[model samples]
Target chain A: METIAHKAKLSKSSPVVRKYRALIHHQQDMPVQPDISVKHLNKVYADGFRALKDINLDIEPGEIFALLGPNGAGKTTLISIICGIVNLTDGEVKAAGFDIIRDYRKARESIGLVPQELNTDSFETVWDAVSFSRGLFGKPPAPDHIEKVLKDLSLWDKRNNRIMSLSGGMKRRVMIAKALSHEPRILFLDEPTAGVDVELRRDMWEMVRKLRENGVTIILTTHYIEEAEEMADRIGVIRHGEIILVEDKSRLMSKLGKKELRLHLQSPLEKMPGQLALEPIELSEDGYELIYTFDSQQEQAGVARLLRTLGDLGIEYRDIQTRESSLEEIFVGLVNE
Target chain B: MNLYGVRAIYKFEMARMRRTLMQSVASPVISTSLYFVVFGSAIGSRMGDIDNISYGAYIIPGLVMLSLLMQSISNASFGIYMPKFSGTIYEVLSAPVSYVEVVLGYVGAAATKSVILGVIILITARLFVDYDVLHPFWMFAFLVLTAITFSLFGFIIGIWADGFEKLQIVPLMIVTPLVFLGGTFYSIDMLPEVWQTISLFNPVVYLISGFRWAFYGVSDVHVGISVGMTLMFLTACMIAVWWIFKTGYRLRS
Candidate 1:
C-alpha cells in the first residue's frame, strides 16, 4: 500500500505538484541552511556544574523536531543559550543563518521562545503583552497580526483582560501567543504541554502542525513521550546533557522497537524443557505462559519454528498474543541504559 | 538602534506609572505640598531672606531637586527590578535589543517621569511661594541632566540587587541622608566652617547648588563647578551602567 502511494506521489502530474517538485529540486540544488545549528556547545555554571557538554545539533527548517530528555538533561540550558538568555561557556550557535553572538539582533529576531515557567506581566492586558513581545523584537506594530495571533490562540476575547486574571491553561496559551507575536521563522517551545489539559494539548498539536505547514521550524523539548511520538517528524533523545540519538521518528521506532509474543499454556510446567531453554523465551513464574522476545525487523523472527518446537515438546497453548514496545518503554530503557 | 524595542520598554514602564498614578505622581506632590505648607509658608515667614531671595522661594529648587533625584532613582529601579523579580526580564535579555537600547528605554522613561514630576512640583510651589527661574534653559538642563544621571544609577542598582530590600537600601540609607545633608532646606554656609567643608564632599550639594543657581542666580558653589560635578557624576553612572551590561552582572548566567 505504501509503495503504491509512493509511486502515485512520484507520478502525479498536477501543476501544483509539478511546481512543488520543481521548487524542491531547486532547493536541493542550493545549499539549504539549517534553521538552527550548534557546534561543540558547552555551558558551565558559576558553581562548576556543567549543564551542557560539547553539544552539537542542527535542526532543519520547517521540521517538527522533538527533543526528549530526562529532567536535568540540559534541554532548557541548551535552548536558553541558543535564545541568548543563558551564556554559553564555549562553542558557537547560529539561528536562521545568523551567528548568535555576532549577529544577535538578527538571530534573536528570527526566533521566538515559550519558556517552561509561566512568568508573565500579570498587570498587562493580553493585547498589550502580545504587542509588546512583537515590539521587543523590533518589529513594527501590526494590530491585525496581533489580533490574528490572539484569535488563533482563543485569546481574542480576553485581549483586554489582565494576565493575572487568566487561568493557568489560558496563561500557557498566552505564552504561545507572545512567542508567535513577532512572526518568527523559528520557535522553541520548552515543555509546551507540561501542565496543559489533553484537549489543549490536542489543540496545540494542531496549531503546531499548522505552523509547520506555514514553514516555521519548531524545536520542542518534551517530557511526554507520547507528545513526541504524536508530533515529531524527527526525534532526538538527550541524556546527561548529551544527545544520544537523533533519527527520523518512523526509522527510530522501526529500528529500536521490540516485539513480544506470549503463549498461554494449556497446562502448568515444572520448568522450561531442555530443548527450548536456549530460545529467546521466558517461562512465567507460574509456568502457565511462555513469552518470546524478538526484533521485529529481523528477516527470521523464528516465530513458526518456536511454535513447532513447542508442539513437538508436547507444550500446548490456548491463545497467542503479540505486543509492540511503545516509545515510553523504549525511552525508559534507553535512559536506564 | 532597535527603536521599536526601546519604545516598547519605555511605553511599558510608562504604563506602569500611569497604572499607579496616585503613588507615582499624587503622593509625592502631596508630600511636597505639606513641606511647602510647613517650611515654606509658616517657617519662611518667620525667617529672614538669604542671598536676598525670600526664604520661601529659596527652598523651591532644593525641594524640586530632592524629589527629582529620589523619584528618578525609584522609578528606574522599580521599572527594571520588577522584570528581574518576576522573570519577565528573560524576554528583554533575549530580545534583539542592544544594551544601549535597553538603557535608553528604561532610563529615558524614568527621567521623563522625574522631569514631569519636577515640573508639577514647581507649579505647585507657585501656590505657596513666588519664584523665578533666572536661567530657564539652565534650569531645564539641570532637571533633565539630574534625572537622567540618577535614573542610570537606579538602573545599575536594579541590576545589582537580587532582593527587593536591596533595591530600597541605596535610595534610602545612602541617598536620603546625602540629600538631607546636601542643603535641601538650609544653605551650607549656615553650617560652621568645618561642617561646610564636610558638606561640600556630599555629591548632592553640587546638584542642589547647580539647580539653585538656575533658579535664583545665587548658589553655594560656582555654577561651573556645580555643572562639572553633575557631569562627572553622570559620567560615572554611565560607566557603571555600561559595565553592568557588558559583564552581564546579575543579569545573565
Candidate 2:
C-alpha cells in the first residue's frame, strides 16, 4: 500500500491526478455518502422495449453493493446507463456528485467499469492496455500506479504479454487492472467471475475484498446468489427491470430466509395429526417424517412448543434436524414470487 | 479535447496497424505496385499519351487516388469494426473522451496510414514511370484531403456494418467499382458522350479527377468542382458521424 502511495508521487503533476489524490484524502474527512446515486432511472428503448423501469439506487462509499438478477433482468442495462454505455431515456445518475450526462467527464473519471464481455485490444500488451485506459480518462501517465495495479492483479509478470496470448482468467484480471488504472473511487464489475474456475473465483472474491479495503466502492452484478451472499455488504434483487428488494446481506438472509425442521418418526403415519394440522407443518410423502417451515427472522421459532405438542399427540421421533435455506433458495423463491 | 484519450486511441490503432504490417501496409502497396506494373508498364508501352503526358505518367494520380480511396476506407472501417466485433468499443464509449475525440483518434490514425501508403505508392510510381507533380503543394493537399475524407466515409461504414462481410461489401462492391468507372485507367472522354455524363455522378470521379489535375495540371472536371465535392462529402460524413455518436447508433444498447 505504501508502494502505491510512493508511486503515485512519481506521476506528472497533473491536476486531475492531484485532485484525485486530494479526493482520496478528503474522503476520510467527510461522513459516508453514496459514491453513486441513481434517481428514478427509466430506460425505454425506441421500439418501446422497456429494459428498466423507474429504478432508484444508491451505493455508499467503501461498501460492496451487489446487484443480483437472473438473465435479462436489466442488471447490465442499469449498469450500462450509469456508465454512459447506454443512454438513459429518463432519469438521472450521478457519480461522485457529477451527473452522468451533464458532467460526463467528471462522472466517468470517478468510475471504472469492467464490462461483462471479455473485450480487449488483442494485439496490445497488458501494460499498454491498462496504461492507455488510464490516459483515456485524462489522468497523467503514472508508471508507478500502473505497476501497482498490475501487481495487485498478479499480472506484473505478464505485463509485456499481448492480450491475445493470455488465458481467460488473466484477461479478466487485465480488464480489472485497466479499470483500476486510473485509481477510480468507484469500480463496477459487471459479472466479475461468470465463467471462471473455482480457484479463480475465490481469488477474484479476495481481490474484490482487497479493493473494498482500499476505499474503492464496488458494485458488481452477478446472477450467482452465492457470490452476492459472500461478497456484498448490501444486495439488490432486480427482476423484470424492477428493483424488488435491497437490503443488507445478513438482514436479507435472516428476513426472507426460511428454516425447516424435519422430524424422523419412529413409525409411519398415514396422515398429518389433526392437532398439528393447524400449525404450519406437513407430513412427508413416506409418512415417516414431518416437516415444518418457519421464518428464520421470527423471535421464537416455536421449536419447543412443536416438540411438546408432538409429545402430547403421542408421536415419537427418532431424530430431528433443522436447516436454514441457503441464499440460492431464497433467491429462487424471490424470483419465482 | 481529451488529448490524452485521443493519443491513447490513436497510438493503439497505429500499433495494431504495425502488428499487421504485411496485411495493412504491405498487401495494399504490393497490390498497387502490381497495378502499375501491369497497366502502367505493359499496357502503357502499347498505348499513347492521353493528355500531353506519357500514358504511364498520366495514370499515376488516378492509381494513387484509387488505392488511396480504397485503402483509406478499408483501414478506417476495419480499425473500428474490430473493436465493435470484439466488444471493446464499450471501453471507448464509456471513457471520458467525447465522440469527437474518438472519431479524431480512429479516423486520424486511418487517414495517417492512408496518407503514408499514398506517399509510398507515389514513390513507387516514380520508379516505374517518369511523373512530375506539376503542383506539388496541391498534390500533397489533395492526397491528405482525399485520405481524410474517405477515412471519415469508412468510419461511417464501420459503424453501420454488423458483420465482417458487411464491412467488405462497400469497399469491394461499391467503392472499387466506382473508382474503376471514375476514369482511373483512362480519361472519361475516351468513353462515349452518353457514358461520360453518367460517370460524372460517381463521387470518385471528382476525387480522382481533382487528384489527377494536381499531378499533371489536367483533369476531366474543374479542380474547384473536385475540391468542392470532396469538401461537401467530407461535411456530410462528419454530420453522419456526429449523428451516430449523438443517438448512440449501433454503438450502445
Q: What TM-score does each of the candidates earn?
A: 0.94, 0.91
What does the lDDT come to for candidate 2?
Answer: 0.87
TM-score of chain B of each: 0.98, 0.98
How would the docking of model 1 be graded? high
Candidate 1 on B1-253: residue-level lDDT in tens?
9999999999999999999999999999999998898989999899999889889998988889889989999999999999999999989998999999999999999999999999999999999998988999999999999999999999888888889999999999999899989988889999999999999999999999999999999899999999999899999998898888887888989
Off by over 4 Å in 1: A1-27
Q: What's the i-RMS for candidate 1 in angstroms? A: 0.5
lDDT of 2 by residue, A134-158 (tens): 9898888999999998998889999
Considering the true interface contacts (CA pairs under 8 Å between chains A and B), give the fraction that model 2 also has.
Answer: 0.86
Q: What is each predicted model's overall lDDT from 0 to 1?
A: 0.89, 0.87
Flag clash pairs in model 1. none
For model 1 the local lDDT of residue A280 reads: 89
